[model samples]
Target: MKKRSSVLTLFLSVIMMLSLLSACAGNGNNAPDATNSGNKGSSNSGSELKKDTITALLPPVSANYQARFTDMEKEFNALYPHLTLKIEPASWEDMTQKLDTQVNAGSPPDIAWVGSTGISKYAALNVLIDLNAALSDEVKADYDEVAMKYFQLGNSQYGLPAYLAIHSIGGNKQFLEKAGIDWKNVQQNGWTYDQFRDAISKGVVKNDKGETTQYGFVFATSGVTSKDYLGIMAKSAGLPDYFDKNLKFSYTSKNFLGLLEAIRQMIDDGSMPKELSSIDAGKRWNMFLTGQTMITGKGLASFENSARLNNEKIKANDGSAVADSIEAEYIALPTPTFNGADYIPTAVVDGYIALRGKKDPSEEHIKNIGLAINFLSSGSIAANYSNELFLSPITESARNAAVLEQYPRNEENVKADQIMMSKAVPARTDIPTDLAAEALKIETEVIVPKLQALLANEISPQKMYDAVKAAAIKSFGEDGIVVD
Candidate 1:
């Protein structure tokens, strides 16, 4: 869920093609059909709800936020003719700062998109409205309980989970078959680290000159720091969370050494390229999509959407698209586990939150804002957003309306995605702000630079762990880290 600028660019490019395809397909307005818009809140009757305007801040769900939000607004207006909804598109990177500025100036938007981690912070600021008091029980009941928990603090519900983002390993089907691995089995279940190494090593091809003709795997590097890269993989190794609420830092623990060894072994055997530390994600992704590599780490569901978009362009003979688009399917698999470790993909949940504006509003206005939030966050409208973004719907209504046929999707990949989501757990969202900031500083300033040396094979994993531990202790004090 930590999206890079390049990924956003890719998403925008895909959205352009999606618009063209959907236009040709004639799926009018981009909102679910009235017959299919299951569980949208009851329409306002007679003069029960008075006319009011509510403003919202949302990120671009598609290429054009205006177009998408306009369609949603139209759909919402049909049910609540009296309420006028105005949506402002904000980039994910700038949303928090922008929202803070507005809230400080006593003019926060009625509703906005916020990371689940930020809900508690905003709730503490007294800027958030308790959603439990706002949304109807019928609507709230439809949301997945796991996702809903992120919005709850004590008795107040601060937000509604917008979507589920899962990160997993992706494989090329032809390469898996050539390597004598059953793609279906890998996709359905998962592989152990040893199995992963053996399979990828088998897939490697070398020329007569001893140069690798094709790599077995590629690691995505751009937009990821060393802490994130290792922390996510550590879960598959049955390691505890590296940083916990109790301020215990476990990155130096002995168990973590196994994860480092797995990566080094992968590289030492030539299953992964030595240049992994040098290349950015763009290069690695191109390698995977063009079949230069058989597998990729840090894979996203969005890649499938990208592949579909590329294929659509090829089918349409669009000169703007990549010529050698992926023909064989790209499928996702759960991360390779270590020991008897359970496979759990890293997940981040983002949600919609209603804010208390500068001035106390009338109850009717608050009611209107609640209705607007529910309209955008639940039911078929929410499903449409999830479909476009390749996100898991958090509401039962959205889930029921999530028909893959609505867009370009590989059924196998979709199945694998669902499996990953079922087992996925959210990142720690309750970390205190100051401590979180301190942890981030250590990650970027201390851990990442040494990680580069580790990736380049210039330092042993033990040395890398030791160096980071020393630096962390110096900053956090010896008593802070979990030495075990």
Candidate 2:
């Protein structure tokens, strides 16, 4: 009986051992499957990979600007499947206002395409990220020194320079030929201020009844274009830097006064449109487009548009070619020289600025933003952007590509790029913060109104100078200005 009982106990123990082994095997299989599941769902041990979305604000450059960005977004997304971009378009004025509002509300876009003029202002406000530390040396080397300097404040780079715009007098070839001026020669050897004045005088047309039908030049004296035109004229008059080295307004300088006098003379001679001060920018552009103006300052984009419109056969309501289709061939002339020195007009560098968030962004987020900027500012992208917009490229590779791809098709683009690269000086960078603010105040409150008066023949150059100087002295302190 004892032998039988001992055998039964041994059998039960064997069954229990098997059950323990089976349970251990089950746990081992389940543990790895659970761990693999967790690993598959996460990038790191503690957290899942967070998806990121970046917002970009841009001012409209052309009708197809948004579409181009849309394509770019797709390309960017292909490489970074976890990242997304939302592009928002706005007008220049609206963009500025919206940015201001966004900053105040602590909800600015991650990136923005801002005007070069505003770079300094934004940098001063400490709203932009210092790209000097963020961008790689290889990427920085791709940009032009002048372009890089345009948006630099101290050691910090506030923006990535993108499109460049070199303005030159675009002339109607028919009117220029009638004036006994070869546009090609003028482009090769730039015109003197006197020669420019003479061309304008000769280019003007009148009816048999002495009714003026076409003017030599037309431009609005307000808005961003006016600032560009005025700055170009100031530079051409041998004052490449609008402010003296000491950061004082050079409004009272002889060269600046000469520029004003030349404009007054043009207005008096009917070579320039008289109602320029009152005309809207659209009207001014239309006047140039319709062949009512012979020569006017324009960027490559506008020049191309004018050239296309001039070449296009106008159709009537019935789709028949109108007999009076504007027979004009518009060509770019070298910027006119004043003191025997042709100072090529440096273009306004519109570019992207990465903004500092209200709270510090993650390392990955910062890296992604930098990558986006680098992609946008790449040689190929720069080439394509400038090519499509008819603007000058800011990168050397883009410039070379432009010379090859754009020159054969549109020589004007290449010419503009060459002028910007070789002849254009960097935009003013020495303006002190206090001096800039005062100068801006003087410009809007005092100078613009006085300039309008001078253009209207309501004020003399001396009176304009006196008023501008007095305002500057009052704002910047008497010692700030160089009294001649």
Candidate 3:
């Protein structure tokens, strides 16, 4: 009996070995080819996948902006060899117009970097892909909550935040020290509106003949610049939210009036130059760089980049004696608060949105677009892009990267970013998705002119409020204004 059992076991082992050999032989024919895997648009099975050409429209904000996009292309292509990325460079205005035209013509780009204000507008138009249904939960969780909030409409997400632009009062140290204002201390503990008013007033430079040579603060009082400033001032002063719980225009509070009055007072006191009302954004920034203004409200990225450029120029001329050379050292000052409120810098989280083009794309195309968006919005890419552009990262992992710790200016900017993220009021908080275009129209057509008038002292704060209220009513009707 023992000899018979041993023979049966040996026969079973032989059968198992033969089955394994047969399975291995079958897998050999079905295995993916290794030699052709490196070829573009070729899969491991040696078959060609459908090649997707993705056009990306980006606003050029930095000198090396094109190089940055090129690097992104390489990075993305390394992971997605079948996808071809084409970048189209355009100025901000041109990009906006072109995108609008493309969307209207049903030929939109696959991806676009748009402003915070445009996200809701695009989402409302149903031009943007709903990321909530596209991205995985883990991918969605990678972004900072506050940053993601800016790109959301109701329960749907229209885009992923790419970078955060934190607005602060940047001052030249030489100018601040000459005016007996310690900018370092100001950085540690932000000043109140009253203190800011007095400091800027004293910082105004005059010639020997008592003619004004330089103003204290310079800002462009046109387009979105003036609107952002007014919103920040009014909101930081504890005014009612621009839109109430009902998503209506609620800018008729005393805080709104106070904001306008403050701007008028600054203009009357010679703190803010009246000429700013007509100057464009570029000229306004140049005014600050050329020492025509001591302080200005701008994104920290711009100030940091400007300082770096100036330093590079100075280094290039080392040991060459040049008199009257400008010594430019700029530092970010905390946005001044009002009525003891926390310093809430005017913050905007600009990001990229994926769009479904005029032709209904295949599911494979939609999946590829989602993958591209995820790659662009990843923490590593965000860190690299923000570090290169001198902007703040929108993801927590990117914010805490070791690269940010290496530069003192970046560290300072990161601290400012934290403050802005912690205590920010979205530039357009409660404007409903349906009313986004109307809100922007009212802002440009009605609000900007009134703000300019208020700053120029051509109109009273009450009159400005009345005009804004009337416009709001005309646009949204009385039902749109939330009554407390």
Candidate 4:
């Protein structure tokens, strides 16, 4: 991870650059105009571009993802009538595996939107093309160089970043205020672990029978998985990730023990769901949206708009299944800092990458592929994707075109999200392949299940720590883990 100061400087410059670009564009209130595609610096003319069917693997960007993709295809086809797009939908969890399978079968998709972590993995496999060389300088120059730097391996640029994503918590302001807590203040000034625990515990409400009508907190293994959220909690609270800032394996530190203890304490106090271990991400989100939970873990900024849309549906009553709709206000909050540690939310840069595939695409095919990629990942199209997720647009043209069109945004939520972005360090992409692979193994095979057991109250924090340490030692050897 870069120094906090360096990260802040880069984010600030990105903001300044976006402001200048938007000011120059002069259409501040306009929605993204997908029809005006010719002006966005594509050197490929209609006559020069080759006609071919390009298949793409796309992850779900919203609940109405089918409609979103349909709209995208329409816009893209309108822009390039010669190119045909065959988009395949896949969940984020399954995309990497599906892509790998297709690539190994000697028939990979022409394009896939992948997370930052997958770039290095795929680049190592020699499956991706270098966007840095294929894309025009005008399009390339608009992106924040630091963000683009994450996708580069030596001289080969693996992909073009779509947006910078921050994963944090979302809260129901009504519940917090009912508990006499000022959530706006918490959004501006982050809370400590102890304060967060106290606030949530206080926020828990009971019915006349003393049953938990509203849970203070809830989490599931979707979006930000438990391992990532727990890891980020430890990191923001001054502990190291699986690897420390020095880039050495260091998950067994005492601070890690503290993180486990803090989580268990919340569970014991009845502030969080006791059956949290069994709940999936969909259930957790529904629980929060329907007012059964006061706060949700691993909340993405995009969910703020989801809550708004849900409320709108409830008002319209135009749907068949509007029984569970909620009208509550929501805001995103940074994962609480511990002691005096800096607020750093877990973050990643998502990208649109083109693959060479086994089809052995010709030079013109590759050029056409690059042109399609540039269109999907820049200007209005990229802005639309970013708007769906409420992420900061990485490309200047996207920034200029971005507007809050789909859903109403909470100003407080936007402000809090921006603050978290200023502090977030995109997960380090430079780990040695062998060590990185081992770390991933340890995470899935050991850390996640053990942490789940801890959340389920099946094991004490000490026992969970001990078990994880033993597994880490077995995988990484003593020299790799932090002895302290």
Best by TM-score: 4
lDDT winner between 3 and 4, please give it: 4
The TM-score ranking, best first, is: 4, 3, 2, 1
Model 1 CA RMSD to the hidden true structure, in angstroms:
15.5
Instruction: Kindly give the stretch of ten consecutive residues in candidate 1 with the minimal lDDT sum.
Output: 28-37
Please, what are the lDDT tens digits per residue for candidate 2 over residues 1-484? 9999999999999999999987875552421111111002112322123467878888766545666778778766654556677788888657888887887787888889887777666665667777655566766777778888877766777767887667666777778888898777676657788988888889889999997889987666655555655666777786676478877667766667777777788889998877777765656666666778887665454566545644554532343433334655567776677756566664667788888757876655665566676666655567766766666567766765532233223475456446545677766766765566567667768777788888778999888878877887787677776565
Give lDDT: candidate 4, residue 471: 81
Please give, for residues 1-484, the per-residue lDDT of candidate 4 as tens digits.
Answer: 4799899999999999999986765542222222233234333344444467777888876555545677667667666666677789998677778888998887888888887666656665677877554566666787788688667766767667777787788888888888887888888888888788888888788999999988888877533465665766776766635687665677777767877888888888999878877777778888887788888877888888778777778788888323575787787887887746677777767777879775567755665566666676777777777878878788778888845466667888889988888877754656765666677777778889888888888999999889888888887778778866
Ranking by lDDT: 4, 1, 3, 2
lDDT of 3 by residue, 1-484 (tens): 9999999999999999999987876564533221211112224322234567778788874455656788778766765667777778888657888888888888898888887767766776778876565566656676777778878776777777887776666887789889999876777667888999999998799899987777888766665366666765655665535566667676655556666777788888988887667766666666766677788765465566666566666678864322333556777777677755666666767878888776776656665666676666655666666776677666765665555223446465556556555666654445677687777777778878888787767889889988987888888898886444
| Superposed model 2: Cα runs more than 4 Å off | 1-49, 313-325, 339-342, 357-364, 396-421
Top lDDT model = 4
Instruction: Supply the TM-score for candidate 1.
Output: 0.74
TM-scores for the candidates? 0.74, 0.80, 0.81, 0.82
The whole-model lDDT of each prediction reads: 0.72, 0.68, 0.69, 0.74
Put down candidate 1 lDDT per residue, 1-484, tens digits, no spaces.
Answer: 5578889999999999999986765443322222212355343352444467889998765443446778777777777666678899887557778888998888999998886756656765678887565566666788788888777666677777777777677778788888899878988878888888888898798989999968888876544323445766877776645474576776666666777777787889999889678766567777776677888877778777766676677678867556454554677777789756899777767778888876787666666677787777777777777777777778888887744346667788888888888787654555554555566667768667777777789998888778878877876788887765
**What residue pairs clash in candidate 3, if any at all?**
none
Candidate 4 residues lying further than 4 Å off, grouped into runs, are 1-51, 63-65, 68-82, 92-97, 124-126, 222-228, 317-322, 356-365, 402-407
Task: Give lDDT: candidate 2, residue 455.
Answer: 77
How does model 2 fare in lDDT?
0.68
